[model samples]
Target: MKRFLAFVKKEFFHILRDRRTLLILFGMPLAMVLLFGFALTNEIKNAKIAVLDLDHGPHSRQITDRLLSSGYFQLIQNLNASRDIEPAFRRGKVKLVVVFPPNFSQDFARNDTEAQVQLLADASEQNTAISLTNYATNIIQNYKSEQAPPGTVAPMQIDVQPRMVFNPELRGAFVFVPGVMAMVLLLVSALMTSVTIAREKEMGTMEVLMVSPLSQLQILFGKVLPYLLLSFINGCVIIALGVFLLGIPLNGSLLLLLAETLLFTFLSLSLGLLISTIADTQLVAMFASLLVLLMPTIFLSGFIFPIESMPRFLQFVSNIIPAKYFIEIVKGIMIKGIGLDLLWKPTLLLLGMSAFLMAVSLRNLKPRLNQ
Candidate 1:
């Protein structure tokens, strides 16, 4: 009994002495609980939408006003023409557009025919578009019902026709496949690279390489090159599986998609190298990668959960995650068939992140010349 107690005590001491492990052990549970409880929700909030109020009637204006007041949507633009709706969607500025045809109030008052309101949604993000359309339709219906006289049928009738652009049929796989690609590539590339580099440090080969003729950048590139190729291959496999097994369409340019995948892989590799520099051991590196990369990639990247619904602070935190941008790029290309014109922002963000991580990793990598 005494021997067993001594062994347990030694283990406790070792755990307490390793601050990184101790921190991760305690912090991971807290983060998971907080993220699941708060950030990971299916609800939509502050979704950007545009209003094209061609009617300009009192009833039309009232309906528009109510929509803006609802917490679920933010009115980014009040469009003047029908022509502007497609442009707004293409710019990725708005998910749904509410168009009130002229003589909306007059038609509603007559009750001879139903007054029509068109709800046009950019269905590239099919789930969000569906949610927004449903919410808007419900609100408009409620308003129409309220205008009725007591015990009398309401003369005003509003018919909402929801049109889902890009993806006419809302397929769950369409939304998730791209997200899965991002998460899988990130995990396989970042976690694997970090663990491999940390293994070299633990085994003492890193010092030998440091003293060799190869410069730090060259050594880092050499270490990363194999993983880069492997990650690219993995990406291709995942894309193929999504297309063949899942029946998700690859609508956009295949060459562009491959190029973007390579860029994202580079970002993940740089992040892994950065993690390796921060952690002294393979276990520590693995834990760091899981905590910083995996959790955020899955939860905060709009993978399984919507980022807009998360708390404001969490939304801000998500902006720094590389997977968030990459997922956006993938979805735009695959689902919307959008070109570089619509995708430049997220593409640039990934590029900037790759450069930042590489610079920081190089700075932190102080390979011992003589150990």
Candidate 2:
């Protein structure tokens, strides 16, 4: 009994001394709790919307004000013309557009006529579009009810016409296909590259490469190029399956889509190379890829959950996630059919990230190779 107690005490000390063990035991659980608690909710808030009031009357303005004050929606644009609506959605900030027809207040005041308000929703994100439209409809109905005079037999009726753009069917495939592509490409590329490099290091073959005629940069590129090509092919396969099998529309330029996929694959490979420099063993490389790459790609990329619904801190953390940008690019190209004009920002961000990661990986790798 005494020997067992001593052994247990020694084990406790060993656990206390190992920071990685401590993180796995305590930090991982805490992170899981926080991520699940904050990121798993279906509720959305401060969803961006546009209001187009042709009437410019008090009733239309009041409904718009009520919507803005409901805390569920933030008005990002007050559209001037009917033509501006599609452009508003393509820019991607406006999720729902509330268009009030001419004589909105006049119609509301008349007992016989129905007041019409059209809601144009960017349904690329089906769940969010549904939620925003529902919220707007309810708000408009509440306002209509309040405007009723006491003892009047009937109040003016509000007809909220909701039109879903890009994806009227609200197919689940539309949302998941882009997200799945991002997750699969990033995981496969980063995981395989890291494990391959780490295996070479662990097996002592990296030393042989260091002594070879090739430079460190050449060795790194040689290691990564095959995986980059393979992951790009994997991305293409996912896209094809989504289009042919799942019936997802490939609305944008296929060449541009392929180019962007290549960029994202290279980015993932660079991340893996960076991880390999830090991890001396294949096990550590695999674990690191799962931890740093997989979790954020799943949760924070607006893949499954709406990022706007998360806490401010988590939303801020999501900005740095590479998968978030890639998913946005895929959705833009595949669903919205928007080209480089609107997609330049996320594309540039991916490019910058790839360059930075590749530069750092090579810089860190060269010193290790020499040593």
Candidate 3:
């Protein structure tokens, strides 16, 4: 019993001395709990909205005030013309737009059927669109009931015509396809590259490669290029399956989508190379890939949960996640059919992240190559 206790004590001390082991054992649970606790939720809040109150009457103003004050939405734009609606959605500025037609208050007071409100929603994310329409409808209903004269049946009706844009049917596949593409491409590219390089280092063959005529950049590229080609092929296959089998539309330019996919795959590979520089073993590299890449892609990338619904700090943290930008780019192209004119921001961000990651990886790899 004493010898067994001593062995247990020694193992505990060994774990304490190994920082990576300690982090995996203690830090990961805490991080996962905090992230999942805040990030995973169905409720939506502070959703961006636009208002086109053509009526510009008291009731129109009142409903608009109620919506903003209800704490469920934030007004990002007050559109001036009907033509502005498409530009608002294409810019990703607002998720829902509340448009009160001309003479809205007068028609409602007269109990005319023309007292209608149109809700234009971006249904690329199905659940959010439904939730926003529901909330807006409820608010309008409450206003109608309260405005009715006492001891009388409700005399006014405000028809809410919720028109879902981009995806009128609100299919779940529209949302998940982009998310799955991001997650799969990132995992295949980063995990494979990290593991391959870690294996070479573990087997001592990396030393042999370092001594070869190939330069450090060439050595690293040679090790990773095959995986890059494989990842790109895998991305293309995923897109083909999504379009043909799942019935997800490829509405945007195929050439542009392919180009963006290649960029994202390269970014993921750069991240993997960066991970390999930090992890000396295959197990560590794999763990780092999952810990650093997979979880963030799933949670922080706004893949499953709406980022606006998460806590403020987590939303800020999500800005740094490459998958967040890539997923947006994919959805924008495939669902909204928007071109690079509107997508330049996310595309530039992906390029910047790729460049940064590659620079750091090359810097870290230089000393190892020399040794």
Candidate that scores best on TM-score = 3
For 1-371, candidate 2 gives per-residue lDDT tens digits of 99999999999999999776687688768988988876667788888888889999999989989999988999888889999999988879888999999999999889899989999998899999999999999999989888888887456898999999999999999999998999899888999999999999899999999889998778888988998888989999999999999988989999999999999999999899899888888987887898889988988889888888888988999999999999999999999999999999999999999999989988897787677
Candidate 1 regions with alpha-carbon error over 4 angstroms: 1-7, 211-215, 244-247, 368-371
Q: How do all models score by TM-score?
A: 0.93, 0.95, 0.97
Runs of candidate 2 exceeding 4 Å displacement: 1-6, 151-154
Model 3 spans with C-alpha error above 4 angstroms = 112-114
Pairs with steric clashes in candidate 2: none
lDDT of 3: 0.91
Residue 78 error, candidate 1, Å? 0.9
lDDT score, candidate 2? 0.90
lDDT (0 to 1) per candidate: 0.87, 0.90, 0.91
TM-score (C-alpha, index-matched) for candidate 2: 0.95
lDDT (10s digit) by residue, model 1, range 1-371: 99999999999999999888778888899988888887788888988899998889899999988998999889999999999998888778888999999988888878788999999997767778888999999999999999888899887788899999877887778788878888778887899899988999898888888879998778878988998999999899989988899777788888999999999999999999889888878989989999999889888888777788999999999999999988888887877778898899999999999999988887787543233
Q: For candidate 1, what is the TM-score? A: 0.93
Ranking by lDDT: 3, 2, 1
